[model samples]
Target chain A: MIDVVETTLTWRRLSPRMLVIHPFQEVVRAAPALLGLLVAGSSSGGQGHLWSVAGVALMVVLGMLRWFTTTYRITPEHVQVRRGLLTRKVVTVPRDRVRTVDVTSHVLHRVLGLARVEVGTGTSERRHEGRLKLDALTAAEAARLRVELLHRSPAAPATASTVSPTASPTVSPLAPPAGSTPAAETELARMRPEWVRFGPFTMSGLVTVGVVAGFVSRLVSEGNVDLGRVGPVQETWRWFSAMSLPLEIATVVLVLVVFVSVASTLGYVLAFGNFRLTRHAEGTLHVTRGLLTTRAITIEERRLRGVEVSEPLLLRAVRGARLSAVTTGLRAAQGSQRGGSLLLPPAPRAAAVSVARLVLPSVAGASSAWEASPVTADLTAHGPAALRRRFTRAYGVHALVLAALLALWWWAGLPSWTWLTAAALLPLTALLAADRYRSLGHALTSGYLVTRWGSLARRRVALECDGVIGWNIERSFFQRRARLATLTATTAAGKQGYQVRDVDLTEALRLAAAGTPGLLDPFLVEAQHVS
Target chain B: MDTPTLRSPQHRVSRTAVWYWAARAALGWLVLLAAQVAWLVADSDGSALPVTAHVAGLVVTAVVAVAHVTVMPQWRYRVHRWEATSAAVFTQSGWFKQEWRIAPVSRIQTVDSERGPLEQIFRLANVTVTTASAAGPIKVSGLDRDTAQRLVAELTATAQATAGDAT
Candidate 1:
């Protein structure tokens, strides 16, 4: 382990065409600022052209420098990349440590027949730190490198004895020629045109609009762009001012619904347009998706620990669900279904369940029904105590708010209708509490320890028993008073720890001991029954 | 279900752990009290309105700090326990909100011992063990320095003897 070799290794440069691609990308990145500058200059009669020209020139130069300074090489034993011209940084990862290889191509790259290859090492604490990137390569070379990195063959001998100056793609007989004999692929799920109906339930349109609006508003605020002076803005304001009070509210709501639906529909089509989940003969799951930026990610089935069935409140209402694989070393991109973990998009709950069963053989069961599938199997209820606690917590907040609202109405000059409105909404809160109680469940079936919890964004994780490394039994002050505890099964898969919240203390201990037999036995003191 | 319960781990951290907790709590309270005193002194404009209020605030803080420094240490000392066997490392810690963590010997990736300035002043140490998960590491806090060292060595040796990848 203390051995260090001082031999020089070969390095290769990125495709020269990427230099052109980089400048365009940089220009797009700076478009917001450029728009702001243009607006400011237009308001002040002129002055932004010089700055814009200089900025573009600087960006072009910076983009070209990447092709000059960045170089990477894949040896038989290690994959190395050296980046930067002024302050040199060289990152080398052992060949076997390569977990996932992603080949992504945007519209420009696809047009240029160039692709970007990112090696996911998943070893370092920071996600990006563990990644080694090759800015642009021929689509063929990118595919070859993907095979070369993950195929784990040592047939290439040039890396061992010869210090080659460039990546000799012809010499790498180690990787069975990529795209030669297409491996058998088992297609699990394909995008359906009708699945677009579940788009508005995801609320991604609202999030996208919020993000874009916030960014544009920030830029507009910094500039002199009078949004009210814009033709559409002026017309909209005039139209709004021309309406009666109730009509205006109804119109605003109707317009918002239409806008959100259209935006989310567009987003959904763009994201999952050509979504395909396929299993390869080499024991890897291939996920290829996206519209403008085509992404292809490979996940090793052996690294997969389990699967998670996710259902947000609105999606659940529409009987739509999402399926994500719980795997080690795969990036979990939060709040987006654009990662290696997503197995199915927002589709029919039955489709999501069937896809989950197909993806993970551990969930093989008889029924194809959404509820009967092991992914959504019946769970043990936490009994009336847990139910009571949920109600108390729900009504507890409502009671406090009602007291405050009534106090405000009595002491201050507030209207009484506020408290009355809150009282009228009491039934909604009870429904929510009941839904939360219904969602809280845990079970052990086959080799999977299943735990499901949460209200708004309910997720049911089915983790393999062998993947559990440790257990955390915690009793908060209130939980202790309720004679309940939260048992967290710690694993290296998605989320790291999945908790069976608010369970009877003894039952929790039993669950822990049963999940991974010998792990918790030493800590448990058996209460012998006199049967 | 037999309704089994957890038995507290076999070893209390150390007798000096009480002093360590007390000293740490007292240090935090001292900083709080010092900041409040400085604020009171700086904000006063020879006015009686806020002087009395600040003084009352000082009294309340002092009362809470005294109770925390006195009762919390003893409670923590009683709560903190640890044990290590060939199979696993177990610990029970915290006062009002207690936690029991158990990590199998084979799954432990690394074992480390640390002594902060406060721990050093109290002649105490902490031994931390971790696996590949981002969940909280198992820790044995306020141990005697030599005991922490031995614990680290024992855990490291046990981990070396096992063959799992720790993931």
Candidate 2:
């Protein structure tokens, strides 16, 4: 047996782009500081030239320090980096747990024909853990390094089964050397289409959001009013012609609203240009797009934990549904507020369902067979005794708070109609409760745990049981009283915790038991009872 | 699940961490005190503050400083742990909040050792772990040279093991 020892290796030389762009980019970034210094020096007067020369000299020194300080190296054993001028830093990362080699190119770097390569190791606990960025590398060099590291590292065994087309024509990338082809076929049967592309972009909704934001900012800053705002002006003119000055104000308000909406929609379209999605050979979903600054996001297929498709009340009329997926990593720009998934805004429900089917097959079939298990069947079978009792016990205070609101409205000497309006909330509350009940379902099979829930907007989540690196059960003071518990399952996907809330005490325990076998001691009912 | 059998080197945070935390805490307190004093002076009605209010503010400041000095290091220390196995290196740390993390030998995407000024004086370095998390990556600080080297060795061994297993 060969005794192979790990050693640090020097990184290849910095890409030529680094030399070209580093100086200008640094100067631009430090423009404000330089401006502040110039203003201060000029105000001081007597030795302005001296200070200016000194400042220029300082900036040059700092820039050179930054450039010379940065260096990186990768070996079959570990990755090493040395950086910092005043206080040098050398970091080494092992090869085995490295998850991915991410190559990113900003506008400047792209122009310079260079990319920043971030090596990500598979331990996703802390924000900066297992992450190192090498400043610049040529595209070809980066790809070659990535390929070599991937081959050397063992995190992904299946990659070995995939023979590179360039490496051998006889060997199929998907087919292993021997009997693995049959297993690969079965795996393929189970592997649904993992991503959907819209035009040239995978995340068109995000672009739309950016456009909307830009439009709003422009309206606020530049005072550009659209047709809707002009409508009020026209209305006011008509009113003036008709000798109705008092009503002119109403026309102005109406015009402003119309103008804003039209302008915002136009801006949105302009922002989201040529969106598309492409599946990489490595089972990662790559979303690429941008009119000005193009972006490509690679999301691992297994990291996808859940998919949520939503249709708000206004959207239902338009036959539009938004699709979002929740994965392990940090929240993307579009999904930060709602949690998980990308929102494919305003697609037809059929299209949404088709995409859903591709991503999550088990839950995709549930809508059509919604009746096989009546919405109320689980409610009756499990009954309030097991589930509803726990639900009311957990959220019954909300009902009382609504009742108190109605009582206060009545006491305030407002019109009696106010109380009626407040009382109308009871049905809404019940409807929400029923929706929650209907959406809740769990199935464990095929090395995965599939959980489904949601009301108007439905969600189906599938997680590999083995991939679950940590599990925690939490209960508040009130939760203890209600015998309800929340179970959080954490994987390598960053800190956006996935949870099942207000589950029946017994059911939660059972699910946790099924999901985390040896991780938690078996037959630990005492621990379960505390919650 | 069967626990994989492996051997690892015992590792601890470099002594530099204590001084680092202490200095950081002191600086933070100074900044906080300065900010609070500025706020109080700005918001005060034209008249000078009463003795009671002055005393109360002093007491709060004292309490905050004490808490900062005493709590910061413990919190820092508890949030990180590292071990080097025969095959790979593993580090896991998060306070009462637990994030069970493991970096196998073969799949380590990158390994890097970093040192700031204080760490240089103490001959210490920090190691970072990166995965595909959008929030970015995770890092562990305060490792000595010997421990870092051993970790690199273990990681290489484990990576080789994985490669062997796959083949």
Candidate 3:
């Protein structure tokens, strides 16, 4: 291994493959425009080729210019990036302030043996502050930079501080060079092909299928496909009309269910394929997953506050639950739908809980000094008044809708069976309301305040009491009448606020006081007096 | 909940808030009256609409204006309360829908006070306590100038001492 540790504020360029990638991305960006050009050409008898050629040439030039202008430099103190040709811009993130360094390689990047590096500094990512993204870096260099930036061991920091030219490249900060491994390393979770069965139950599959169908139909229509015969909408409508009304609905639902299941299974396999979670001797948990866009997330143990295990209605029916890390650093990474908080994919509730226990030492189950008795059946439910309120609210809403339907029938001469159909759904709504009311509960343990809420996707979060920074109590007109308040525990970690919904006024105050002893005591007195 | 010792009754905002609210209500009423007048003028072509529509609209507007000017101010005053200790800032505000919040000193990321033209006329200001919570900021408005300044000073001092201590 070469010990060529040159430290002279040397600027680095991204992988040369970015030249290819930049143009490819430009092409992707202009695909719709190009298609429009082609359509225009078809209409105007091949005159659109000139515009298409001009557009492609312009995009290629812009891409090349952008690639040439952007460059990043790694200093001992900060990782600085400079870009923009017209207006020069510079951004830097301090080395020690960097909380997480992620290396992700999408299909294209992977194919080119390149990866995108993201450096997070544990600050709110508003306007892209406290973050840096370097695209199209060689996979090896990305890994090296990740280690170099995160390296805080005595040997590396000392050498780095001195700008020592002889700092060995052989020593890896996180991993012990190629052949050997750390003794304390333990595999916490790994993907199992069979676990894909739980994926379809998430109902996320159905949503994705719908999205894809929408996109495809739009694409086909854009391509000038004959919508009258080729469109799935007309075909489905025709088929449904041929069958009995109920039978048609059932068959359509069944088809949708089948499509969703297939899609979900495939998605689960692709996303969680080769998934691995390991705890290292350094007290950092490393997660690596994805078949097409491989991603690696590193979570420091100290930053982990707790865990949130979510059980959606379908997932709960199959006794499956997903676990997420309640941590500070990963919040910025949780962009779009794929939350970076996910600690485990949808798995058995027991397994998820066990993994959660391992991740957050004292905040998962009943095996710690803090949570002597985990919040289970004995959780303090928001009393009978809450139940009544839920029922009244649910039934009131339903009645209003029914009345609207009746008004439409009377005034607009609508069908009468609509009222009956709506009436038939009342009991189901009532049952759900009852279930939601039943699900509302809160408990204050020795060091954590556990709140359980929701019916469809019930979540029981055991937030560390010390993590709670403030309390927000809200009582609407109806709730004030019912002597109820929604108590939200505000914390810097996790979801920012966890609410104990529809709790008794006194009980909510008590919980608030218990969670942060002195902070809410003054408010509690006034509240208690009023009550 | 273990009740804290009663240091003093929760401090109410400046009494001038009533006039402030009344003035705002007057502005709203003026807007409503203008809209009604505009509707009447636009419908002067009056093919079939009755004179009763204008009479009823004017009556409802008068009633709403009266309630907003007379009733809302008193309700708001009664509900608005705020107290700042070394540990935290406790505030209870909102008239019909009561909201009580306790923002700990350590958690306060920023302490700011705002005064608009109307508030300036009343010599009153609104103190906003922002924390790193997604539920938004805790606001204590309608404070006398002196009290607002003192509150901001006290909060800023304590917040500084507890900076970076928030969990």
Candidate 4:
């Protein structure tokens, strides 16, 4: 350990233990090229392996060079990371602006008792997307850093700050948003292995399969491999082609479902095996999850604006749901499923609702006492206009598809069953439309604006009224004709905008006004008018 | 009109907005028109349609482009309106797909104005009122320069006066 005498403000290098893992990581990163070289080496006879060796050496040198060039320092008011060899790069984040602190360690790092720290300032700006990263710090050091970075208040005006040579001192005079609370951390949720039963309902498996299929197809083509020549492939094709139409269709569907379920189960375990959600007394929510590559994320609860309860159609059938935090700083586009915002992985719907309640405890008197629960309160229906629009759009889409299929049957001499199949889908579509109509509702309750919409991915977003920054009222030509509008309450948190889609024009306006009173007053024709 | 009953915003933007919009629309259409001309030249010999057919094709495209360039701006000008009070900023924009956006002055994060070459020639500017939302930044375009400048200055001051991060 070359670092002698630790100063709070001095530039710090990554743990030297990272030197053991970087070369391996570099090789993994460059696997495709190395694999190609190996294949080409055998196919075209020689020297490709030599090129591969040289490439590995170059990658290792690059990896080791990174260790030498990179150094991070915590100034009185900011956290700065300096890296790059020739074109020097420095990323500085005001300490108070720091939103999240993530400490992750892969299998190798875990073995070496080292972790990587990622400080998330949570800005979606293109120039500096993720704040800063310090790779391969000792596990204890990373844990200590995460706490020190998030829980501790930024420098007060009294401290005379020293600027690191690599950094230009741009110290902010602003006070930290939350003073550190010295309360004990409370565990909100822990992953139960039984929750893996919800794995099959998630679409993650299909995504993995699609990616693998694409890669395989590309590899087959690139290598000019004749899959048809493979004995097993030939036998499978023959058997498949010989099957009766209905039997073949059934077989394929059965195989797909089986494969998808298995993949999703694997993914679920890999991602959420040891997931735990805890609230720190110092105003941070900690989520430690992922099996092989463990991650511990620290989020300031003061930045939390709300929580979302999401139920995909399939998951809803099984009473399974997911939960996410609606908070400032994090980019909405990154998605809650894979990041710091994920409050709970797919679990029992009851579990998600409970977690939501825990995350957003309702105000005593302010919360609508009549409702059973604050987060899952009975919402105000969007009325007949929205219902009519739902049915119209639903049948309109079905009519378009049926018409197209019928045209093919009449003009192009296609099978009658093709049109019949399209017609047969009507009942399902009708069911969906009805379900969607049922879900189309919004309510202002419990100091939160809850907008529930969508059938496929039903979301009941409970955003704090205080978090809403603006209002957007959009009426399409059809919506105008129907006298309905989509009111989007835009905020800095979560998805940024949660829409109460296809509500009556007057109703949308009323809801917006109620959510953030007085803003819409001057623009309304009559503040109290509902019709 | 048998439309929904909220009152329209106070201002209809500078009448010069029509000309500015026409120029903006034309700039886009001209490139498409140029591409059509290029493609026609490239394929003319191979397709060898009757001269009348080629002439008709070109004429139809030109007619459509010109009609769009002319009618869109007029429609937009009629629809685009804006109002800014000390309390809130309201804007209505777009022609067929109209959007009505309102951001409280307290929630507003930034007030910026931009002028492009086309806007400069028309003596028009666009005033943008940004909030902390990703779907925010309500813009009132084609304002006369004087109004745009005053609006930016006034909104900036109003936003600063309000407490909290506004989100």
Candidate 5:
């Protein structure tokens, strides 16, 4: 017979510290009534203290109710949590299915010695939506729970002599024997890293953001301007006259440069504040960092889906790359509605490869294969054919549209220069169309499908053929006439649809058949017979 | 390989499908005509309506409605039964253009039921079956409350049984 503990545990057992959201979040919640009181008091010119006092009292009461209403429970078999004051929610998750547990502490939570733990179970159901705010567990407690939850096996002995002295009987019913090798401890020891940091935040980046924010806010609040109004126009004209034309152009360029620099710098800082990544001896990747809010994420090697390495054009010069792992379940920290993309950005290509190998043993040699024959052939031939087709297609409609518009303007007695402007648009459109065409390419082998595309920013996505869950080939009436087909490949990470438009029918079929071995023939027949 | 074990047969949908088809047909034609008129108005010059564009839009809309009327319900009523020894689920919707899905008893990640105002009036509930993969979340609607409850219970039982076998 099993005895259930009916008493609810306090949030302290989950984590001893308070939440680390923006200080202004609490203030914002309390502000409306306080502001209303102040406005009313100021209008009346005196005697507002009572109203202010009442407002503060109401805020305090609401805050306490909010805190007390949210509670979480952990059991030997499962974890149960209940929250929300009005529309009550009860979430129950079995320990066996829980895949990943992430703990995060914002600056406030860090100060209060509290943290929020998020648990993600790899299930598509609504009830299996990742749990947020499993709050206030100590680092050690959170780690222990995470390890036990992730590694729990029904086949393990029901009773063993090797149970840890510190293990809670309620949480761990059938502990492993003392002398037996502990898999969890070994994994923990292997994956933890030492330190992580962002690129230096230059001073100029901050000023640019402030300026841009100010400019945008001003534009939004002011609405449309009246050029007829002499006062505002005169002020603008005065400022315009103060700067030289060259200086004005230079300033605009400088502002744009500063804007991008600042944004990227800030992104780096926010993402990697005091970051410490460690590989636990047990083969788990343990990442802990944050200046204001500390976060720890553990990625088990077995659960890793794939490794993605990306290199932007700018980064290619320095051989800088970003690495991210695709894994089962959500890995977002607590109090964060959005999840990180498992990225390690701006590292050397070698470092990226090393990280990929460490996390995904299967993908170890996959990066080297990136430079192999098929990839090179696919990349070089992909763009030129696409560009040729784009030029041909655009010439039929886009050039005609421009010519007609120019003719209309010329007949309307507009300046001949306007016709020149219209004619110029044709060449520009053709150039853009060609560039777009040149960026598309695809290659497929038995094990993988590699797609490379992009004009300004290049992207190469490599997907394992066996991992492809769904595929489709679509052809419109126009595409049928043109002998082209579009193929879409869907994996666990949303849908990636690629078009091999304007390819010979035979080639298209062959390519489709190669990427999705059993699916293409039926899909092609269905598509061809659709009309 | 040995023959796969098959689960029990799924309950069929009640025969209120004709009304559903009529409702869909009316909405589809109305929306199609409205969209055609909107496009014509937006693209028209300030002068008289472009005769070619106007006629083309009307013809396209009519053709689309004709296609929808033929395709909609045939696909909706076509039902299929999918069952494996450890998992069982039923998929029914349309004949030609259909939604064919299967969830094994062991693969069921979550079970949920919802009832709208119309469903409440008709005492019908829709049950959604979720799986480990995010792509497919099967929704079987127009089931009576008793039927929906029984289906849920059956699925839960099979899921538990399969889980037990695996362990």
Candidate 6:
């Protein structure tokens, strides 16, 4: 156990090594600019060198000054961080409000045995004022600070109620502060090398390959390398020019497949290498992963509301799924589809579910509302009108595209085969539309509202009803014509809007009314006779 | 099925809301017109566009400005409805695509009343109710100044009272 000073009031500076580390980080950040200067100087004769030197010097001074001035203190009531010379700002987060203590160590920091710690105050707004970050600290000290900040007494009435009562049996022996014993820690999941097989199944492989190839080509071009002179390029180009059209296309595709597979395998290794999830006695789930720059994310057990299992179309073919925690206080990027809630990388369906159960016990336990196996979960399908709408909308969009393509073919003489291709894709679109309708289902389990939707990348989330704070009902004129409405149950956890789409308006009203009983009663028109 | 009535029917905003929206639309048109005038003047001095092209552009702009100044305010007035109870605030807005939002008092983080220069001249105010939900704040515009102030006060009081442990 690392020795920890228990003083609460005194302000503290991070390890002095931070001064060196911060300046080093600044230099590393300035490397690209320095490289650009070098390139320019070589091209234009020495003017850029002076600017590069000045920029590096200024960054070093600023980094040193920042390190020297910044100080933080964990008082009994709040965690206060005071810094900035010219701006001079103070950020204070109440102790109870601190939700997550994320520790990350870059390759450099790891070599120096230091980690960066960020204390989040649980506010989802991207305001720096609500967060406290310590740029560098010993790995042990980071662990201890995480434990100290997250440690809540089991006897505390407020938090105890949130934790499963059965967990109390294991609580007594684990009461000592973290870093005290390894015996109470339980390893929940670890990365399996075989899971890399699912990496290519995700569309990310092709995207990653394309990105890397583009970047490499750009770099090569900048360095005055003739791409056509490259061995594979020259050979392929010569062969392609000589070959039949179909064979040429096949060869190109084969090369792409090979590149994508290799990139996917590499990406999986970089992301999930040595991935480990463990539950501390203090009820914080620590997830550590990554090969190059290891990241350690701490999630308080109580803040967890539920779990989501997503299976993309390609991944689903092989029974692979990814798990994400639907919890409060987790950072969600503005307008982005994915949040910082990934619990398990794409893996075998069984493995993902097993890990989800371990991380979130309530998801599968006897007292659970949702099923242990989401596959077996009896979800209620929406009305047939919803299916009709999906098909009509899907086909309508495809028809519009086809019409535009036809018009282009008539006006500008586009390839007639392109029209044939578009025509052939209609069946696939119809199949997808049918699958989307089949995927749309919602259920009010004992304590959770489980909604499943999407065709390309389907997500089935079982969000705890208790976590719901509000209910929104929307009916567009088109939806009204179909007597349908979208009901979104707004919860602090997970995506802000989780919709039970294209349900009968009355059904939506009833669901909203039932989710939060008295809250919506005032707004809902009662039936003439109480059923 | 028989048409169902909303148990707590929403209240339409003040009629002055039309004037407020019309003024805002006019202001937007004014800015666009200023830019177009500047562009037309610059084009005339040097690379003058065809007479027909300029006439067509001006005609489209005028038609759009007229439609916006006349039709939009009415549509907005018809679509926008809000209801506040002790438990939640329900706001329904948008014309072409209606949006319905509900924010529970328990999740209320802040309540603010804003009055722009145009709104001030029209004696109208907008009350914004912010929640932790990422859908962003709910703006109930076109309230009488006194009503906006009172609603803000009432919402603040309710928020304080019902503020339990929430993110």
Tell me how each candidate scores on DockQ against the true complex. 0.63, 0.05, 0.44, 0.50, 0.09, 0.46
The predicted structure with the larger lDDT, 2 or 6, is 6
Candidate whose lDDT is highest: 1
Q: Give residue A446's lDDT in candidate 3 (0 to 100).
A: 47
The Cα local distance difference test for each model comes to 0.81, 0.50, 0.74, 0.80, 0.53, 0.75
Could you tell me which residue pairs clash in candidate 1? none
Which runs of model 4 end up more than 4 angstroms from their true locations? A1-6, A29-41, A45-64, A122-130, A153-183, A221-224, A333-337, A367-372, A399-420, A527-531, B1-5, B45-63
State residue A294's C-alpha deviation in candidate 1, in Å: 1.1
Q: Candidates ranked by DockQ, best first?
A: 1, 4, 6, 3, 5, 2
TM-score of 3: 0.86
Off by over 4 Å in 3: A1-8, A29-41, A44-69, A83-88, A125-128, A149-184, A229-241, A332-334, A363-378, A522-531, B1-9, B22-62, B163-167
Q: Per-residue lDDT tens digits of candidate 6, residues A127-240?
A: 545667888778877876777678665554344435544433322212344546688688888899899898777666787876667655544433434567779989977867
lDDT of 2 by residue, A1-531 (tens): 011111123345566557666667766654544544444445544454455446656765676566677887665566777787778787777655454455556678777667666665545324454466776778666655555443332333345334332332211122122122332211211111222222222233445556556655544332323434568768966656784555666665665555554554443344333444444444544444434433333445545554555555334445555555555443423321122235243456666655554554243324444322211112212234325743574358656765676677777665666557656666676776676676566655544555555555554455555445444454554554565555555555433345565555556556655675643332232432221
Off by over 4 Å in 6: A1-8, A18-61, A124-128, A155-180, A206-248, A332-339, A361-376, A399-424, A527-531, B1-5, B8-10, B29-61
Q: Give lDDT for model 4.
A: 0.80
User: If you assessed candidate 3 against the hidden native complex, which CAPRI class would it receive?
Assistant: acceptable
| Model 5, position A97: C-alpha lDDT score | 55
> Which candidate gets the maximum TM-score versus the true structure?
1
- Report the Cα lDDT for residue B163, model 5: 54
Worst 10 residues of 5 chain A by lDDT: A188-197
Model 1 lDDT per residue over A1-531, tens place: 001022124587788899889889887777766667766775563555556668887988988997999988766578888898798898888776676777889899999999998776545423446567887988988887887666643444444335443444333334455545465567889999999999988878897779788778856764657888899989989989998998998998998788888889888888788999988666778788889888888777777888888999989989999888887666466432246578888899999888877776554443445565458678888878889889999999999999999999999868998999999999999998998999999888766788898789998988888888899999877888888899999887777788998888878888888888988777777665311
